[model samples]
Target: MTTATPHHLPGTDLALEQLPKVSLHDHLDGGLRPATIVELAADAGVELPTTDADELGAWFAEKSNSGSLVEYLKTFDITTAVMQTREGLERVAREFVEDLAADGVIWGEIRWAPEQHLARGLSLDETVEAVQEGLEQGVDAARNAGHRIRVGQLVSAMRHADRGLEIAELALRHRDAGVVGFDIAGAEAGFPPSRMRDAFELLAANFFPATIHAGEADGLDSIRGALTDGRALRLGHGVRLAEDIEVSTEGDGQVARLGRLAEWVKDRGIALETSPSSNLQTGAIAQWGTTLADHPLDLLYQLGFRVTVNTDNRLMSGTTLSRELALVADEFAYDLDDLLVFQLNAAEAAFLPVEDREALADAIIEGFEKAR
Candidate 1:
């Protein structure tokens, strides 16, 4: 069993936190610090199960460990409830970046659905601006703390809602500001990417990139819809794509075969945002097992898929990118070289420009080389 006490992998210390990293699939709402959540919830008059930060953090960990997506999603109510107004959103975004910087993230793209934050009378544009303001503040704070961190917003439209086009335009409006990309999140089963065709069309016409929450709560057809209808450049929790891969045992190792869809994702180098803890929490990898060892990340990595490690929700999953990599390393027995590949995958798949992507890659390579 995994211990509750957090410890670094053998010979790695906490050095992984010092290794420059790029995060492509982190969620702003999913990553509030526990103490900050307590303060924000109190100010926003949001009721939480516990006021103690440690207990609150443990509550999130316990709830998400239930191995059901429904149970896992219930924890978000508190986080998003306090995030309804401008202050709540700004503080959370700002602290999110601070926490990422402390975790050694050099670059991160935070995704959140603005439509969900409109409940407190904030317009879609207002919500985006508030988040941008917080992101800038976080960047300044990181710089002051001597940790250089760059963050971008990925505006998400709740697929269950019908405001995709409006959210898409909001993303476009802030493209030059703090917004970097677009995404479709929430209820990935019935509300397929096809349901947001108008929004994807607008984003595509505007030459904006998108990453859809596919292959998580749904199957291969959902992934297909994400690629075809949403025109997703990356796959969120695309772990289920392993369902399309057939593994046959050989003498010592295994031989694998990929379906056409999996082949396309592999050949195109579409990034797979594999979050170990959150994937298990959401039952996204239930077909495999209830353990990290059952995660198909190793299979996908071996097959040359662009697999990047992430913490879908830091609070909910009770994880950091360092912790996620440690868990995967433990399960897969991966060394420093393997971890560097994951960082490089995320750096390459980042929504930054070509030159910036190269720079991020260089940073990751340098960090890994030092660790080795």
Candidate 2:
């Protein structure tokens, strides 16, 4: 299921797919290969609306673009159904890495809710093991293909569910087995991270890192709880944090004033995992506009926030790391240096050890310098 490297873009001389990158917020379930999904569905006796890969891909895009969160979430239902078995999860996870490597991602964090995969009778531990096995194989495959890539797992707990504590422990249990972090990612508005305070506390006590979904479907309050209660080291699509900043165009220069929350986030260097296309699909940037150009990423970037571009759901958004960066570059007039900064920001914010993170940063700098 590895994607072929795209050689050239339609109207540009640059091949964005050729640039080195880091993917910090990609989801394992959200990046499945369409053809694989169809095959898996047939094997599992699960029904698919469309069996053709091209049509199925369009179906995802159309449903996600419906601007309804409920409709968007329905897509995951199909993906998760086929992933009930160990084989399904392992294959998907392995292909996820191969696809990332083909897209030029040097490092990535693949997040998924292990709790959701137990419906077919797999234990929580088994689910993690399955995905970890896939990731290891994927890494080896990529290496054999002459592409160097590293990936880690971020086990997520469904926010509305009451298994946060269990999921947190599951993540910590497999800390040495490829699970690198914890997260709470379902509906973000009503189900704030505070609901999982005890889970976050356990992670904190265990010295486990976490990132929460905030500022996408919710506002600053969800973000506050993510930082204060969840102790999130990074935010999943924290795009709405822009609500806390006011930009005033004065006589000569523009004056940007940060609210207390914005000031705290910026000062603390909490990474904003902004996924532009997904944000638009989910109406996370409704206050701004209905296009990539209207995203507040540039503002956050200029204001010193640790802004990183991501493809929240590659299938739903019909995007890649390269396409997301191209979209942002077109919107913000970002040069190769700016693109390098985002990759470096993500590498620094990754849940790796300091030495490993430093290595990742060095790799990014070298790649970008070569590209320039």
Candidate 3:
């Protein structure tokens, strides 16, 4: 969609973007086009750091790459600012889907906190409807363009805020519409999933799915709370769950000793929505190492964990789903087969009906075979 073409796997003619993929942890507020931001900001009278689209895009990348949590978070403030009105939300959501389709995403779960988009006086219900409209429009547009894609909203509640129960109910209310699940996002350190236990309990009672943001800005204890208290079906950026793993060298080779928490996650087949670039920018993988090569994703995958690659924040991280996969493949020497595993992992972990997930799995297999 942007100027950049789909990246090909090194040493192969296969274009990574041509493969079917599923995105579980992508944020709606984090994937806006820089040009859209400028136009939206201009209409809303919101001043930006720069008016040039290229410069604005670079600005987002610069702040997100600064390694300061505060600076990284400020980028969202700019994005959410432009998405307050119904029209803005709808347009952004529509473009989000088009971009995902262009990146060869067959299925995507877009997560964003509705509470952050209420500045224009839209009620929670209205906000959800507005986004759903945009998503549907995007789907139709993508289909017309010969790109078959499906998307569902993962209605997110800000963890630092006290609206978890309200957001969870909204998600359930719209379950038949466009929302697929509920999630609690935003700051992950001090605010544990336990803070939203009541909301999670409500979702559990209603048989609604949820994926809690855990172990990204926090540690294993937070992840434990996500499972025990939040009852998350999948973990958003659970990259830090690797903290429970202890790797050591022996006479013949190396071995990874999994702690109780890590073992539980691995044995349970809980999907880890890992975004390589975002994890590095947010220091989620700092405890493991400094670069993508040092990321614990490879370790988790080798240990038989359900590790699905993602682009947590496309605009902020300056990446697409394809780019994310390509980056990981380069870092870990992953071939087409390894890449297929990641897509299949995501397909199985998608919060969809059992039949739908199976169909998605079949599609992935077919697409990968064709790409090969």
Best by TM-score: 3
Over the stretch 8-61, how does candidate 3's per-residue lDDT look in tens digits? 897888888789899998999999999999999999999999999999999999
Q: Write the per-residue lDDT of candidate 2 for residues 121-226, one digit (tens) a residue.
A: 9999999999999999999998898888999999999988989999999998999989999999887778988788899999999899999999998899999999
Q: C-alpha displacement of 146 in model 2, angstroms? A: 0.9
lDDT of 1 by residue, 156-192 (tens): 9988888899889999999999899999888777889
Worst 10 residues of 1 by lDDT: 1-10
lDDT to native, each model:
0.89, 0.90, 0.92
Top candidate, metric lDDT: 3
Task: Look at candidate 2 and tell me the lDDT of residue 183.
Answer: 92
TM-score of each: 0.96, 0.97, 0.99
Q: Which stretches of candidate 3 lie over 4 Å from their true place?
A: 1-3
Give the per-residue Cα lDDT of candidate 3 at 214: 89
- Model 1 C-alpha lDDT versus the unseen true structure: 0.89
Ranking by TM-score: 3, 2, 1
Return the candidate ranking by lDDT, descending: 3, 2, 1
